[model samples]
Target: MSAATDRTATLYRMVMPQHTCPFGLKAKALLEREGYTVDDHWLKTREETDAFKAENGVRTTPQTFIAGERVGGYDDLRRHFGKPVADPKAVTYKPVIAIFAMAALMALAASWAAFGTLAPVRAGEWFIAIAMCLLAVQKLRDVESFSNMFLGYDLLAQRWVPYAYVYPFAEAAAGVLMISGALMWVSIPLAFVIGTIGAVSVFKAVYVDKRELKCACVGGDSNVPLGFVSLTENLMMVAMAIWMLRYVF
Candidate 1:
């Protein structure tokens, strides 16, 4: 209603993404009517959408906030006037724990599941997983990566190239070294890196693993869910990194 209020600041909202979801459109219309600016995250990917919900604690479409206060969705936005929003409690970012945890977990799993130790594996899976594990260990240990668990939103990892391009090759290489009786010492470190990278690749799913995003690390044939599994996998990698530190320099 007042010029000072209009000039103070604007609110932002997020919409549950669909093929051109109307909820977002309606919310935008309402904001405009109230002389408020509307920002849209589009809710395209689960990571983005989940982050939105986590930050706001709301899950429905057309989530709204003025300045900093959550004003609810479309209906809620229509009710609020152009006003500076009350700031919510601050959210902290913690990536080190996530990264190391993921590495440790994946290392453990790769040592066993991927390498026929923890859970039983088919002959093919065993052969493949062993090699995969060996290289994973090596990759995890020595790669010159500065990213935390999720690769810090790298486009390469988001597109699955790190996994498809880097991981499979590392896994296959580790597998060969083991089957062919190559240098165990060299192979151990190499496998550690491989496992670490593999884990990071999985955690990087937070970037591109949308609801419809299919995984590419397992030759289009994986049995893992998208969200929590990706996170847990990262924690596994972090653990593995710690494990490998005992062996690798």
Candidate 2:
């Protein structure tokens, strides 16, 4: 087929009164983004949609045709154009990277707004504190799931299941206190003890035992791997605790 012919796509999608197919919209957008001249066709009724599906031997709408050949659904079209389709179960650091990046930005913004300049030292502290709060929020959303995942590698959590449930709250408390530079007595110990325990637990699990597991750092449902990133989180908490101690002593 000619390149010009390949650039012309025929799309059949469902646009019902009650609901429009999201995948259909996605397919159209994707085709346009890839420089295709899309011949958009909508099946406005269930009967028409069913008839089209039956005639074409396809179970779903958002079907795309290129050069007289079917390219299937949205996912298939993506693959046809050599695009990477997302896999939910795949291990990735994207969540942690996003959290840290946003935390850094928040810290810098806060520093600039409050002090009228980018206070590097203050921003650094805020970054860690904010990151802790964000990570705690992820765990707090589904404590049960987080605890279950935590139990897999945390030595303390393995021995005492309740510690898993308490972990998120402790982290959050420490983070809030750290942010305010108040309640050092509570925050210091909480951060220190938990951080030390977590560091040890992660080390033994990943390095000592050489176990491969998903990290509960982002939450229980995440696909983030248990390794360097998890270890770094614990170490940062420990470091924050020590950093706060300087002010007390």
Candidate 3:
């Protein structure tokens, strides 16, 4: 590669006390990380920034130029390097994994406080309850979004529609009741019914139909895959319902 093409890039970034642009800092860091010698240009004043934008016929700061061609901003720079830029609408397990991690931690803490020990059985109960509640909270954030995503794979929701709306509330109610060890009659049945439906639906969608899709178990907005994690969630609920049923009956 030629020395100029191999080593250099031009970066224009905003650097002011009141309006220091974060993307500008990220762009500089990215360039350095990727071993590029950056010709760093700072827009120190608002007028200077405005003038730069007008001159370039662009409206955003922290613009990059490689080989004297405008490469836009931070996200654009990432693309230029073939890095994965996060898409907000994309499906991912990040949200679901985060909730499960937090739920387990909360369960451990609660178990310790209540039992003065991590009682294995009780810890399992607490973990499932907290996980259910946390997942329900995500779904409740935007029920309509959750329902729409849910209908894509959920058998009952696709047919009944209203079941999608009711699912979150039922999950939350079952979770809360299980936590308190109260109203097993209500919680057990609720858990069993939903868990059965969800398990069957997920099995058919992924294993039977061979359709790849997002799981609404975490929330409508999540990118959690419709597979093992989802199946496990349903199975946990089903097991909890049966376990709790033994106590009630």
21-133: candidate 3 lDDT, tens digit per residue: 99999999999999999999999999999999999999998999988788899999999999999988776778778988998899989989998998888888989999999
Please give the lDDT score for candidate 2. 0.95
Pairs clashing within candidate 3: 91-223, 92-223
lDDT of 1 by residue, 1-249 (tens): 666554332433444345555767877776776565555556676677677677777767667656556667655655565544432333212232343445445545655654566553233233333434543453445343312332333345556635433554555565555444456465456566645654555555444554423223223222223355444443443343344344435
TM-score of 3: 0.78
TM-score of every model versus the real structure: 0.28, 0.92, 0.78
Q: Give the distance in Å from residue 69's predicted Cα in candidate 3 to where it truly belongs.
A: 8.5
**lDDT for 169 (candidate 1):** 51
Candidate 3 wrong stretches, greater than 4 Å: 1-51, 64-72, 76-84, 87-90
Residue-level error in angstroms, candidate 2, position 158? 1.0
| Candidate ranking (TM-score, best to worst) | 2, 3, 1
Q: Each candidate: how many clashes?
A: 44, 0, 2
Best by lDDT: 2
Tens digit of lDDT per residue, candidate 2, span 1-249?
Answer: 688876899999999999899999999999999899999999999999999999999999889999889999999999999999999889999999999999999999999998998999999999999999999999999999999899999999999989999999999999999999999999999999999999999999999999999999999999999999999999999999999898899
Q: Which order, best to worst by lDDT? A: 2, 3, 1
